[model samples]
Target: MARTVRFHEIGGPEVMRLEDLETGEPGPGEVRIRVEAIGVNRAEALFRSGEYIEPVKRLPARLGAEAAGVVEAVGPGVSGFAKGQPVSSVPAFSQNDYGVYAERAIVPAAALLRRPDGVDAVSGAAVWMPYLTAYGALVEVGGMRAGDVVALNAASSGVGLAAIHTANRVGATPIAVTRTRAKRERLLEEGAAEVIVSDEEDVPVRLLALTGGRGAEYAFDAVAGPGVTDLARAVAPGGTLLLYGALSGRPTPYPGFDLGMPALNVRTYTVLETTRDPGRLRRAEAFVVSGLRAGVFRAVVDRLFPLEDVVGAHRHMESGARFGKIVVTVTG
Candidate 1:
C-alpha cells in the first residue's frame, strides 16, 4: 500500500487527509518511483483553495508538483533509466495527476531527470520549480546580460533566492528587495549585490542611488499591486520589467503615463510561456543541473516535515516565516 495526502474539498489546510492507496506497475514509457522528498509550493495552496486560474477538476485531489525519489520499476519501452536509480521529476499538471505527494508515484519517463551525484534528495526536490522559473524569467525572458543591473523583490523566497544566485552566475548585479531588515545580511550573503528593505527604505530612491540615478536594467517583481509602480520607477529607460507573481494578492498597477514616457517594456511572464518550447526546457534543465554540479547554485532548505504534517507546512509557508524552500519528507 502507498500512503498519500489527498484533499476532498476546497478549503484551508485542515481539509487535507492522509490515506492509504494501492500502487500498480508502470505502463509503457512510465516509471515508478519511491518518493523520498516533496517540495511545498505556493501554487498548491492556491490550487487547494480554488483561487488559481486552473480549477481542480475532481474531489480527493493529490497535491504536489515536484519530488525526488529512487526508481523502483521501469516500463518496458523506457531506456537509459534503471531501477534503483536516483531521479527527480517535474510533474506538471498536464503530465501526471494525483500522485506526487504519495509514498510512490508513476510518472512519464520524459519528466524524469537523473539526480546529479553531488545533489541529495532534499535539495533535488527543492530545485525544480523555483530554479526553472527563475531561469526562464531572467535568462530567457529578461535577457539579462553581463554588467546589467537586475532588481528582484521577495528576495528571500525560493524563487527570489534562485534569481539572486542566477544573476550572480551570469555576472549581473543583483539588487534584492525584502520587507524584513533581518533578512538583509543573509540576502547579501546569498549573492545579492545589495539588499533593499521595502518597508524601511524608499525602494525607488535606493534603487536610483545604487545605480547612479540610471535605475536597474531589469526588475523581476513577485509582489504585484501598487508595489509594481515602485518597480516601474526603478527601471532604466527601455528596460524590461518582468512581472511573474502576485504575492500581494492584488493586480499590478501601472501608471498610464509612465509606460509611454520611458518607453519601458512591461510584461507579465510565466514559466509555462518561456518553457513551452522543447529546446528551452532542455536548456533550462541543463543550465540548472550544471549550476548544481559546479556548486554555484545551492538549494536552501528551511525546514522539513513528515508527509502527515502537511497542514503545518502549508501554514508555515503562508506565514512567510521561512527563508528558503519548505519540504515534506515521505518515507516507505
Candidate 2:
C-alpha cells in the first residue's frame, strides 16, 4: 500500500490527508513510479482551496502534478521507458487524471521526462515546472529576443527566479518586481538587471525610465488584477503583456480599452500549452536541458518536507513566505 495524499472535501491545507491505498498496476499508457520527491506549487494550493481554473470533478480527489521518481512498471504500449529508470513528471496531465503526491503513483507516460544525469531527485522535482513556464511563455510565446527588456512580477518565486535566469541566457534585460524590498538583492544575484519594489516605487514610471521612456518590450505578470492596467501602461508600443497566473485573486481587466487602445498586445499563457504539445514539449525539453548543461539553469529549493508533512508544505506555500520551490521528499 502506498501512502498517498487525498482530500475528501475542498478547503485548506488541513483538509488533505495522507492515507494508505492499494497502488494498482499501471494500465495501458500508464507508468507506475516510486516517488522520491514532489514539487509543491501554488496551483495545487489553489486547487485544494477550490479556486483553480479547473474544478474538482469528484470526491476523495488526489493532489499533485510535479514529481521525481524511478519507474517501477510501465503498462502496455510504453516503449521508451524501462523499469528502474529515473524520471520527472511535468504538469502535462490533469490532476484529476493523475497525481504524484504519494509514495508510489501512476502517471501518464507522456508526462514523464528522463531525469538528466547529475540532476538529483529534489532538483528534478523542482526544475521542470518553473523553467518550462518561463521558457514557454517568454521564448516560445513571447518571442523574447536579445537586447529586449522584459519586466516580470513576483520576482522571488520559483518561476520568477527562473525568468531572471532565462532572460539572462537569451541576452534580454530582466527587471524584477516584488511587493517588498527584502528580496531585492537576492533577485539581483539571480541575474535580474533591476529590481522594483512595487510598494516603494512608481512601477510604471520606473520601468519607463529604465527603458529610456520607451517602456519594456515585454511584461510577464503572475499577479493579474486591476494592477495589470498599470503594467500595461509600462509596455512599449507594439509590445506584449503576458499573464500566466492570478495570484491577486481579483478580476483582471483588459487595459487596452482603458489605455485608449494603445498598440499593446495582451495575452494569457499557461505552461500546459507547451507541455501538452508533443512538438513544443520536445523543443522545450531540449532548451531546458541545454541551459542546465551550460549551468545557466538551477533549481532553487527553499525548504524540504517529508511526505507526511505535505499539509505543512501547502501551508507554507500559501503563506507566501517561500522564496523558491518547496519540495516534499518521500521516505520509507
TM-score of 1: 0.94
Clashing pairs for predicted structure model 1, backbone only: none
Superposition error at 317 for model 1 (Å): 0.4
Clashing residue pairs, backbone N/CA/C < 3 A, model 2 = none
lDDT of each: 0.85, 0.95
Task: Report the lDDT tens digits of candidate 1 across residue range 1-332.
Answer: 89888889999988989889887999998899999999888878888888765788888788886899999999989998998999987744441264588899888787778888888999989987788888888898778989999999989899999999999888999999999798999998999999999889999999999999999999998888877877788899888888888888876677437556676888887766634456777888899988987888978998999998989999999898889899999876
Model 2 scores worst on lDDT over the 10 consecutive residues at 91-100
Q: Model 1's lDDT to the true fold?
A: 0.85
Point out the worst 10-residue segment of candidate 1 by lDDT.
Answer: 90-99
Per-residue lDDT of model 2, residues 58-129, tens digit only: 979999989999999999999899999999999998888888999999999999999999999999999999
